[model samples]
Target: MSPTEPIYIADETVRALIDEQFPELAGRELGRRYTLEDQFAMRIGDDYGAIFPRLPGRDEHYARVVDLITPHVDRWTFPSSHPIATGVPGHGFPYHWTLVQWISASTAGFVPLHAESARPLGEALREVHTPSPADAPLNPRTGLGLPELEDQFSSLLAFACDRGAPENRSIDADAARAIYEEGEAASQDVSFTWTHGRLEPRAILSDQGAFAGILLWHNFGAGDPAADLGYAANLLSRDMHPHFWAGYGDVSEATAARARAFQVFAALRHIQIDDPFLMRMAWERLMELGLVHEA
Candidate 1:
């Protein structure tokens, strides 16, 4: 991480945190460090990894995402990084933190677009999708309700038109809108299930090319599972998607429709921000997602 980042905390201070709150596990070597939009994470000791999140919003339940997901899919994900005893913010650490079992350097990145890895990715998703309690924490994505999602989709379509790029210019806005409408209608009746909301490839961890543990529970909540799969559908190759769904068990028509809808919006996100690289990826991902078709 750049020293320029304000969230950068010294290793010694982290060690101080360990000595103070988790002395038994203190003094372990720090492994790869991660600086993410919401969190700073690093590996420590032979057994534990930890994250300090710049958690947003006033939602009291947001902080408990790890706590909630652990028990539901303990066998599927890395075990919960239970909060160690820490009080009064020692070492100038500014936000709440949590620790879980460290995944070894043996772990590797998950690439769902590849055929061989897609099936395992599906199974990993299934393991954590059990029913969520009625009181499950709210996902911030809920802030982008169906109407907002639709509007964003339309707006991005217009942005595509404005850019006049071949890929963007070729998109059939009416057809894309139809996909979103179908998804909205399909999702209307399904009851909430536990959803990771954000299931991008970067979020899953692998050991020797096999699914080991999944991470990033900050957006977890009780919601539509199709929306979860929808994001995956866009990320994974279309040919490999069957393997993903096969591992995931059943997919009702409604589920499939919602999945397509969710993916359309997910891909459109790149256009909404107008990041050329990401926008191009989004357009390509839509084809892989099967939302775009050859004329």
Candidate 2:
């Protein structure tokens, strides 16, 4: 399965499975090239829609996808024994099928099960961090090294910042320099190690000082949780909500400092990418948060 090669699950195959079990969508036109995030989608005439089944870990990872979509089908039914989207060889994860509804030529709706909406991060954290007896079940999962996780986090942060747009007002040179310096200092002190190869935070705070926290702890190991906190804070200052940071237990001075530092680091990431949207968004967030002031 080369990356360039298209992984196709034939329409007839999909239709056959649907017809045998869930006949309602049997005759509908389905798309063949759905991405990882675009698992179960339908195209009726010119309209496009998606459906998402509950994934195994990290409910917040799919929050944005769910937030933007609504249920379209009458009854929820599992479509096929196999996932509709196949994983490319180099790709790390498998793509699965979800239900989708086409509304019009340009619009569609997505349906997600309510069970996928929330997670239990706090309990998971306690379980993972607690010292277990020698005879206790030992999880055999491999963890990522600090350097590797940091590199990954840097890349992800840069990518997110590049995609984010700056606000209408521009940021001053002095303020920009300050943000860069601050982020660099913070990164040096932050750790990045995790049981999973990915570096993600359980919570995030937007520029408006709002918080968003995922209730599920996807994977665990030793790392600077502050780095993720910083990343989320940076995202929040970029106009994204901090709702993900909610219910993350008490906010500490360390968390607050890291959040501010990451906000700056996020701004620098946008600058590195030369992404006007993210830069502008970062600048606007700084202004709104009073991290920067115009001369």
**Index of the highest-TM-score prediction:** 1
Off by over 4 Å in 2: 1-168, 179-222, 234-246, 251-255, 270-281, 291-295
What lDDT does the true structure give each of the candidates?
Answer: 0.64, 0.35
In order, what is each prediction's RMSD in angstroms?
4.6, 11.5
Candidate 1 per-residue C-alpha lDDT over 1-295 given as tens digits, one digit per residue, 9 for 90 to 100: 4543446678787778766777777777877677655566777767777766544442343446556755665365433233332222567765556666665533232322346767777876787577777887656563244655776677877876455444333666677788888878764555677777766545666556655556666577777777788877765656777888898888789878878888888777655643444566577776654455444
By summed lDDT, the worst window of 10 consecutive residues in model 1 runs over 79-88
lDDT of 2 by residue, 161-253 (tens): 344433333344445445444544443442332211121221211112211222112222334444444443433323333333442344455
**Which of the numbered candidates is closest to the native, going by highest lDDT?**
1
* Count: clashes, candidate 2: 27
Residue 28, model 2, lDDT = 59
* Worst window of 10 by summed lDDT in candidate 2: 106-115
TM-score of each: 0.77, 0.36
